[model samples]
Target: MDPYLLSRAVSELGELLRVNSAMLVTAESCTGGLLASTLTDTPGSSDWFAGSVVAYSNSVKQNVLGVPESVLEQHGAVSEACVLAMADGVIRTLGADYSVAISGVAGPSGGSPDKPVGTVWMAWAWPGGSRARLYNFQGSRDQVKHQSVVAAINGLLGAVR
Candidate 1:
Protein backbone atom coordinates (compact mmCIF):
# COMPACT_ATOMS: atom_id res chain seq x y z
CA MET A 1 0.00 0.00 0.00
CA ASP A 2 1.07 3.57 -0.59
CA PRO A 3 2.37 5.22 2.56
CA TYR A 4 0.06 8.22 2.24
CA LEU A 5 -3.06 6.16 1.59
CA LEU A 6 -2.26 3.72 4.37
CA SER A 7 -1.72 6.55 6.83
CA ARG A 8 -5.00 8.21 5.91
CA ALA A 9 -7.06 5.05 6.12
CA VAL A 10 -5.53 3.93 9.37
CA SER A 11 -6.14 7.34 10.94
CA GLU A 12 -9.73 7.43 9.74
CA LEU A 13 -10.42 3.90 10.93
CA GLY A 14 -8.92 4.59 14.32
CA GLU A 15 -11.16 7.63 14.75
CA LEU A 16 -14.27 5.80 13.65
CA LEU A 17 -13.75 2.84 15.94
CA ARG A 18 -12.89 5.10 18.84
CA VAL A 19 -16.06 7.09 18.32
CA ASN A 20 -18.17 3.95 18.08
CA SER A 21 -16.37 2.19 20.92
CA ALA A 22 -15.94 -0.82 18.71
CA MET A 23 -13.13 -3.27 18.01
CA LEU A 24 -11.99 -4.71 14.70
CA VAL A 25 -10.47 -7.95 13.44
CA THR A 26 -9.04 -8.86 10.09
CA ALA A 27 -8.86 -12.14 8.13
CA GLU A 28 -6.36 -11.85 5.36
CA SER A 29 -5.18 -14.13 2.56
CA CYS A 30 -3.64 -12.69 -0.57
CA THR A 31 -2.58 -9.51 1.15
CA GLY A 32 -1.21 -11.49 4.07
CA GLY A 33 -1.26 -9.28 7.20
CA LEU A 34 -0.91 -5.97 5.44
CA LEU A 35 -4.23 -4.66 6.73
CA ALA A 36 -3.40 -5.53 10.29
CA SER A 37 0.08 -4.04 9.95
CA THR A 38 -1.33 -0.84 8.52
CA LEU A 39 -3.90 -0.43 11.27
CA THR A 40 -1.40 -1.25 14.01
CA ASP A 41 0.93 1.43 12.71
CA THR A 42 -1.23 3.99 14.47
CA PRO A 43 -0.43 4.70 18.07
CA GLY A 44 -3.07 3.64 20.62
CA SER A 45 -4.72 1.50 17.95
CA SER A 46 -4.95 -1.28 20.49
CA ASP A 47 -7.85 0.61 22.05
CA TRP A 48 -10.10 -0.45 19.17
CA PHE A 49 -8.10 -3.03 17.28
CA ALA A 50 -8.91 -6.42 18.63
CA GLY A 51 -6.74 -8.84 16.65
CA SER A 52 -6.08 -10.30 13.22
CA VAL A 53 -5.74 -13.73 11.63
CA VAL A 54 -3.63 -14.11 8.55
CA ALA A 55 -5.45 -17.09 7.14
CA TYR A 56 -3.32 -17.37 4.05
CA SER A 57 -3.89 -21.08 3.64
CA ASN A 58 -7.10 -23.01 3.30
CA SER A 59 -6.17 -25.12 6.28
CA VAL A 60 -5.85 -22.02 8.47
CA LYS A 61 -9.14 -20.69 7.15
CA GLN A 62 -10.88 -23.92 8.02
CA ASN A 63 -9.20 -24.69 11.31
CA VAL A 64 -8.59 -21.24 12.76
CA LEU A 65 -11.47 -19.24 11.32
CA GLY A 66 -13.85 -22.21 10.89
CA VAL A 67 -14.54 -21.65 7.25
CA PRO A 68 -16.28 -24.77 6.05
CA GLU A 69 -14.11 -27.17 4.08
CA SER A 70 -17.01 -27.72 1.75
CA VAL A 71 -17.15 -24.03 0.97
CA LEU A 72 -13.50 -24.03 -0.05
CA GLU A 73 -13.93 -27.08 -2.23
CA GLN A 74 -17.11 -25.81 -3.82
CA HIS A 75 -16.40 -22.15 -4.44
CA GLY A 76 -12.60 -21.99 -4.14
CA ALA A 77 -11.03 -19.37 -1.87
CA VAL A 78 -11.62 -16.10 -3.71
CA SER A 79 -15.38 -16.30 -3.97
CA GLU A 80 -18.23 -14.34 -2.43
CA ALA A 81 -19.31 -17.31 -0.40
CA CYS A 82 -15.82 -17.93 0.93
CA VAL A 83 -15.25 -14.32 1.93
CA LEU A 84 -18.62 -14.09 3.69
CA ALA A 85 -17.84 -17.22 5.62
CA MET A 86 -14.40 -15.86 6.47
CA ALA A 87 -15.84 -12.60 7.74
CA ASP A 88 -18.35 -14.38 9.94
CA GLY A 89 -15.77 -16.86 11.12
CA VAL A 90 -13.14 -14.27 11.99
CA ILE A 91 -15.60 -12.17 13.98
CA ARG A 92 -16.58 -15.20 15.99
CA THR A 93 -13.08 -16.62 16.36
CA LEU A 94 -11.46 -13.34 17.35
CA GLY A 95 -14.53 -12.10 19.26
CA ALA A 96 -14.38 -8.70 17.66
CA ASP A 97 -17.33 -6.34 17.28
CA TYR A 98 -16.67 -6.05 13.57
CA SER A 99 -14.40 -7.72 11.01
CA VAL A 100 -13.24 -7.82 7.45
CA ALA A 101 -12.06 -10.81 5.39
CA ILE A 102 -9.98 -10.73 2.25
CA SER A 103 -9.20 -13.45 -0.31
CA GLY A 104 -7.74 -12.85 -3.73
CA VAL A 105 -5.62 -14.01 -6.63
CA ALA A 106 -2.95 -11.35 -6.49
CA GLY A 107 -0.35 -12.47 -8.91
CA PRO A 108 1.50 -12.18 -12.16
CA SER A 109 0.86 -15.84 -12.95
CA GLY A 110 -2.24 -17.10 -11.14
CA GLY A 111 -4.66 -15.86 -13.78
CA SER A 112 -7.29 -18.24 -14.98
CA PRO A 113 -9.76 -18.05 -17.82
CA ASP A 114 -12.53 -17.46 -15.34
CA LYS A 115 -11.14 -16.11 -12.09
CA PRO A 116 -8.06 -14.48 -13.57
CA VAL A 117 -5.27 -12.70 -11.76
CA GLY A 118 -6.16 -9.76 -9.50
CA THR A 119 -9.60 -11.23 -8.75
CA VAL A 120 -10.33 -10.29 -5.19
CA TRP A 121 -13.26 -10.89 -2.88
CA MET A 122 -13.77 -9.10 0.42
CA ALA A 123 -16.39 -9.26 3.12
CA TRP A 124 -17.20 -7.01 6.08
CA ALA A 125 -19.30 -8.11 9.01
CA TRP A 126 -20.89 -6.33 11.93
CA PRO A 127 -23.49 -7.43 14.42
CA GLY A 128 -26.51 -8.81 12.57
CA GLY A 129 -25.15 -7.87 9.18
CA SER A 130 -22.50 -8.66 6.54
CA ARG A 131 -21.50 -7.56 3.04
CA ALA A 132 -19.23 -9.06 0.36
CA ARG A 133 -17.85 -7.86 -2.96
CA LEU A 134 -15.61 -8.89 -5.85
CA TYR A 135 -12.99 -6.70 -7.49
CA ASN A 136 -10.96 -7.31 -10.63
CA PHE A 137 -7.99 -5.09 -10.03
CA GLN A 138 -5.34 -4.80 -12.72
CA GLY A 139 -1.72 -4.71 -11.63
CA SER A 140 1.36 -6.61 -10.58
CA ARG A 141 1.27 -8.86 -7.51
CA ASP A 142 2.28 -6.13 -5.11
CA GLN A 143 -0.04 -3.63 -6.73
CA VAL A 144 -2.96 -6.03 -6.59
CA LYS A 145 -2.37 -6.64 -2.91
CA HIS A 146 -2.13 -2.91 -2.32
CA GLN A 147 -5.41 -2.30 -4.07
CA SER A 148 -7.08 -5.07 -2.12
CA VAL A 149 -5.90 -3.68 1.19
CA VAL A 150 -7.11 -0.19 0.34
CA ALA A 151 -10.44 -1.44 -0.93
CA ALA A 152 -10.95 -3.63 2.13
CA ILE A 153 -10.33 -0.67 4.44
CA ASN A 154 -12.63 1.55 2.40
CA GLY A 155 -15.34 -1.11 2.47
CA LEU A 156 -15.16 -1.40 6.23
CA LEU A 157 -15.35 2.37 6.62
CA GLY A 158 -18.40 2.44 4.37
CA ALA A 159 -20.03 -0.48 6.13
CA VAL A 160 -19.74 1.09 9.54
CA ARG A 161 -21.18 4.37 8.31
Candidate 2:
Protein backbone atom coordinates (compact mmCIF):
# COMPACT_ATOMS: atom_id res chain seq x y z
CA MET A 1 0.00 0.00 0.00
CA ASP A 2 1.50 3.31 -1.02
CA PRO A 3 1.55 5.86 1.76
CA TYR A 4 0.04 8.46 -0.54
CA LEU A 5 -2.91 6.25 -1.44
CA LEU A 6 -3.48 5.35 2.18
CA SER A 7 -3.43 8.99 3.18
CA ARG A 8 -5.84 9.77 0.40
CA ALA A 9 -8.23 7.05 1.56
CA VAL A 10 -8.07 8.32 5.08
CA SER A 11 -8.77 11.83 3.95
CA GLU A 12 -11.65 10.68 1.78
CA LEU A 13 -13.16 8.66 4.59
CA GLY A 14 -12.77 11.51 7.01
CA GLU A 15 -14.56 13.80 4.63
CA LEU A 16 -17.44 11.39 4.13
CA LEU A 17 -17.84 10.73 7.82
CA ARG A 18 -17.73 14.43 8.58
CA VAL A 19 -20.31 15.20 5.95
CA ASN A 20 -22.60 12.51 7.31
CA SER A 21 -21.95 13.54 10.90
CA ALA A 22 -20.86 10.00 11.76
CA MET A 23 -18.17 8.71 14.04
CA LEU A 24 -15.87 5.77 13.34
CA VAL A 25 -14.18 3.17 15.49
CA THR A 26 -12.07 0.09 14.93
CA ALA A 27 -11.40 -3.32 16.43
CA GLU A 28 -8.09 -4.66 15.18
CA SER A 29 -6.22 -7.91 15.44
CA CYS A 30 -3.58 -9.14 12.96
CA THR A 31 -3.04 -5.71 11.41
CA GLY A 32 -2.49 -4.51 14.93
CA GLY A 33 -3.21 -0.80 15.08
CA LEU A 34 -2.10 0.02 11.54
CA LEU A 35 -5.60 0.67 10.30
CA ALA A 36 -6.35 2.99 13.19
CA SER A 37 -3.03 4.79 12.84
CA THR A 38 -3.57 5.30 9.13
CA LEU A 39 -6.99 6.82 9.77
CA THR A 40 -5.53 9.13 12.39
CA ASP A 41 -2.61 10.11 10.17
CA THR A 42 -4.66 12.75 8.45
CA PRO A 43 -5.10 16.05 10.22
CA GLY A 44 -8.46 16.78 11.87
CA SER A 45 -9.38 13.09 11.91
CA SER A 46 -10.86 13.54 15.34
CA ASP A 47 -13.95 15.02 13.79
CA TRP A 48 -15.00 11.53 12.68
CA PHE A 49 -12.49 9.16 14.23
CA ALA A 50 -13.60 8.01 17.64
CA GLY A 51 -10.95 5.52 18.75
CA SER A 52 -9.71 1.94 18.30
CA VAL A 53 -9.41 -1.27 20.26
CA VAL A 54 -6.25 -3.26 19.52
CA ALA A 55 -7.46 -6.70 20.48
CA TYR A 56 -4.36 -8.71 19.70
CA SER A 57 -5.31 -11.57 21.99
CA ASN A 58 -8.39 -13.73 22.17
CA SER A 59 -8.96 -12.56 25.70
CA VAL A 60 -9.18 -8.93 24.65
CA LYS A 61 -11.38 -9.82 21.72
CA GLN A 62 -13.71 -11.73 23.97
CA ASN A 63 -13.65 -9.30 26.86
CA VAL A 64 -13.13 -5.82 25.48
CA LEU A 65 -14.80 -6.22 22.11
CA GLY A 66 -17.42 -8.67 23.38
CA VAL A 67 -16.58 -11.30 20.82
CA PRO A 68 -18.14 -14.48 21.98
CA GLU A 69 -15.97 -17.28 23.26
CA SER A 70 -18.09 -19.64 21.22
CA VAL A 71 -17.36 -17.64 18.12
CA LEU A 72 -13.63 -17.77 18.71
CA GLU A 73 -13.71 -21.45 19.61
CA GLN A 74 -16.00 -22.49 16.79
CA HIS A 75 -14.94 -20.11 14.03
CA GLY A 76 -11.57 -18.89 15.28
CA ALA A 77 -10.52 -15.28 15.48
CA VAL A 78 -9.78 -15.12 11.76
CA SER A 79 -13.30 -15.87 10.74
CA GLU A 80 -16.22 -13.86 9.39
CA ALA A 81 -18.21 -14.54 12.51
CA CYS A 82 -15.60 -13.16 14.85
CA VAL A 83 -14.94 -10.09 12.75
CA LEU A 84 -18.65 -9.39 12.49
CA ALA A 85 -18.99 -9.68 16.21
CA MET A 86 -16.06 -7.39 16.67
CA ALA A 87 -17.48 -4.88 14.22
CA ASP A 88 -20.81 -4.79 16.01
CA GLY A 89 -19.13 -4.68 19.39
CA VAL A 90 -17.02 -1.67 18.56
CA ILE A 91 -19.93 0.24 17.11
CA ARG A 92 -22.21 -0.55 20.04
CA THR A 93 -19.58 -0.09 22.72
CA LEU A 94 -18.03 3.08 21.38
CA GLY A 95 -21.30 4.59 20.18
CA ALA A 96 -19.90 5.04 16.69
CA ASP A 97 -22.04 5.34 13.62
CA TYR A 98 -19.64 3.14 11.66
CA SER A 99 -17.04 0.57 12.56
CA VAL A 100 -14.49 -1.80 11.10
CA ALA A 101 -13.03 -4.95 12.56
CA ILE A 102 -10.09 -7.02 11.32
CA SER A 103 -8.62 -10.33 12.37
CA GLY A 104 -6.08 -12.41 10.47
CA VAL A 105 -3.07 -14.63 10.29
CA ALA A 106 -0.37 -12.28 9.01
CA GLY A 107 2.97 -13.76 9.90
CA PRO A 108 5.92 -15.93 8.98
CA SER A 109 4.44 -18.48 11.36
CA GLY A 110 1.29 -19.39 13.34
CA GLY A 111 -0.86 -20.30 10.38
CA SER A 112 -2.94 -23.46 10.24
CA PRO A 113 -3.73 -25.56 7.18
CA ASP A 114 -7.21 -24.11 6.98
CA LYS A 115 -5.94 -20.56 7.42
CA PRO A 116 -2.65 -19.79 5.76
CA VAL A 117 -0.58 -16.75 6.37
CA GLY A 118 -2.26 -13.65 5.01
CA THR A 119 -5.72 -15.08 5.52
CA VAL A 120 -7.72 -12.15 6.86
CA TRP A 121 -11.36 -11.60 7.74
CA MET A 122 -12.60 -8.03 7.88
CA ALA A 123 -16.02 -6.69 8.70
CA TRP A 124 -17.55 -3.24 8.39
CA ALA A 125 -20.71 -2.09 10.10
CA TRP A 126 -22.96 0.89 9.46
CA PRO A 127 -26.00 2.03 11.37
CA GLY A 128 -28.42 -0.25 9.56
CA GLY A 129 -26.34 -3.20 8.39
CA SER A 130 -22.94 -4.89 8.15
CA ARG A 131 -20.76 -6.78 5.70
CA ALA A 132 -17.72 -9.02 5.88
CA ARG A 133 -15.04 -10.28 3.50
CA LEU A 134 -12.35 -12.92 3.41
CA TYR A 135 -9.02 -12.13 1.81
CA ASN A 136 -6.13 -14.37 0.88
CA PHE A 137 -3.27 -11.92 0.53
CA GLN A 138 0.17 -13.06 -0.56
CA GLY A 139 3.12 -11.25 1.02
CA SER A 140 5.47 -10.89 3.89
CA ARG A 141 4.26 -9.83 7.32
CA ASP A 142 4.49 -6.12 6.69
CA GLN A 143 3.00 -6.46 3.25
CA VAL A 144 0.11 -8.53 4.54
CA LYS A 145 -0.63 -6.01 7.22
CA HIS A 146 -0.44 -3.22 4.70
CA GLN A 147 -2.83 -5.04 2.39
CA SER A 148 -5.22 -5.59 5.25
CA VAL A 149 -5.17 -1.92 6.11
CA VAL A 150 -5.77 -0.95 2.51
CA ALA A 151 -8.66 -3.37 2.18
CA ALA A 152 -10.08 -2.31 5.51
CA ILE A 153 -9.99 1.35 4.53
CA ASN A 154 -11.56 0.63 1.18
CA GLY A 155 -14.27 -1.42 2.85
CA LEU A 156 -14.98 1.44 5.22
CA LEU A 157 -15.21 3.87 2.32
CA GLY A 158 -17.76 1.68 0.61
CA ALA A 159 -19.81 0.88 3.70
CA VAL A 160 -19.92 4.32 5.25
CA ARG A 161 -21.81 5.64 2.27
- Give the TM-scores of the predictions, in the order they appear: 0.95, 0.98
1-31: candidate 2 lDDT, tens digit per residue: 6788888888999999999999999999998
lDDT of each: 0.91, 0.93
Compare the candidates by lDDT and give the number of the best one. 2
Model 1, 4-61: lDDT tens digits are: 8778878888889889999999999999998898889899999999989999999999
Top candidate, metric TM-score: 2
* Candidate 1 stretches greater than 4 Å from native: none
Model 2: what TM-score? 0.98
| lDDT computed for candidate 1 | 0.91
Candidate 2 local accuracy as lDDT?
0.93
Off by over 4 Å in 2: none
